[model samples]
Target: MVGAFEQALLALMIFVIMLGMGASLTPRDFYLALKRPYGLAIGVVSQYGFMPFIGFLLITFLPLPSAVAVGVLIMSCMPGGTTSNIFTYFSKGNLALSVLMTVTSTVFGVLLIPILLLIYANALDLEIPRENIIATLVLLLVPVAIGMGLRRLNANGGAVTEFMGSLLAVFFIAFILISWVPRNWEFLLTTTPATYVASIALGVCGIAIGYAFARVLRLHPRNARTVALETGIQNGPLAIAIVAFTFSGTEAQSYMAVPALYSLFIVIVATCVTFIFRRANTAAEQKMPDGLL
Candidate 1:
């Protein structure tokens, strides 16, 4: 069970993360979405469509406890993490499209997450209360809007907001390392290999399906890569927040494990993906002549 101090810290971390997300955005980002709606549309479809399906299959096949399955499903339902933008950059992807997709998906997530979670929970015969889901979603959107407003009101606020966002990211990692991991050491140690496999499969399949879907839609290579990263790198902190808020005591602790593990696993997978893309990009660049460049 999470203590009062830990619960308060978790809430603060989530707010800061969302604020950073909003700080990163501007009216211009939304305008960009309108101008290149197809990329955004395709990204949203791939994120919501493929990831949830992947989570469902994993939960059905794997022997995850009920709480862990719901946790995984919630993580799958979330928007692309800010981390995906970094991975997209490393992978030589469409950075602009990546940002746009992240912003668009997050905005859409305020509504979609609750709805998708309800649907998946019902299908899986899980009993997550609808009210709790709605409450969590509302809590999430409030801070995001405030951050967006801060940026919109003052041009310079974006820089500060971004800095806060980055700082919050570090704090989140540290909190997990120093607090969550140690507190849940027993569960972590006892975690099944299948749980690890399921988490890995979710990330890998999300990237692959997103890329294939983009290719099928005739998107450019860079755009395809961007979609793949966005689809695979989910908003894990948001998942953690939802679990913490909606459940309590041992239930919260059990549910927290999936997103916690996923948060670490996806980063490693994304790094590998980034390395492969970087090497391929470098080779392609070498093959091209200077004159063409």
Candidate 2:
């Protein structure tokens, strides 16, 4: 009974997030690809290349259970979140690039996440189930495509799209809270010390490494800030749902819960990074030339 409820909750959560993601898109969003392409490149490369490497290193040194290690790697391998775009916009980052990045990463994730997870799991001596991979793709890709279709139908111009977009955001938040509260209440209280420590460590490491990489590459401060936030934060609710549903039919290890733990950690880390960037922006503005100011 508990298992069934968990799966249902996860499915609902994914649908809500995907719908929100789709409703937020505009036709010009796709067209803008030709105008400014580098933003998408930066977003995608940092998301796929940098985050996964950090996860691999964290898993290697963290002393976590094998399932937990796999869970972290899978979460790192997943796409950027709609929330990351919001954060990027608020921080004066490139909103268009963030949106395109999220869209492209999600589309690629249909295949990339499963393949990467399978390879990583195999390296850890974990069994890979082909059926589970298909299930993950179905749950993620189906709603995304449906939501995009709905948006495209009303793409010409309408308040309906905007209304749906706002409602989708509310629905996603509610679903995540609902899905989270039931399953995680106990785990939050009883989780091991190592789990908490590792979650914090991973969160901190992701932000610092991502920020330094972007800085070294000479990305604009705004883009660097966005990349750091996107790299540190993830589509964690989706990840948690995937694990809960995919492992429900089998005796999956309790270590699958680590993604949930990491999800919470990412929120904390993102919040801190946001504040830091805001302060940095203030400092930069104060130093601006009189003409610019």
Best by lDDT: 1
How does candidate 2 fare on TM-score? 0.82
lDDT of 1 at 217: 72
Clashes of each: 0, 0
In model 2, the Cα lDDT at residue 293 comes to 6
Cα lDDT tens digits for candidate 2, 65-149: 6666766777777788877776676676656556777776776677777777777666666655547756876766666666667
Whole-model Cα lDDT of every candidate shown, in order:
0.80, 0.66
Instruction: Compute the lDDT of residue 142 as modeled in candidate 1.
Output: 86
TM-score of each: 0.92, 0.82
Pairs of colliding residues, candidate 2: none
Worst 10-residue lDDT window, candidate 2: 284-293
lDDT of 1 by residue, 19-70 (tens): 8888888888788778776766776787787889899999999998888887
lDDT of 2: 0.66
lDDT, residue 62, candidate 2: 72
Candidate 2 RMSD computed on C-alpha atoms after optimal superposition onto the true structure: 4.0
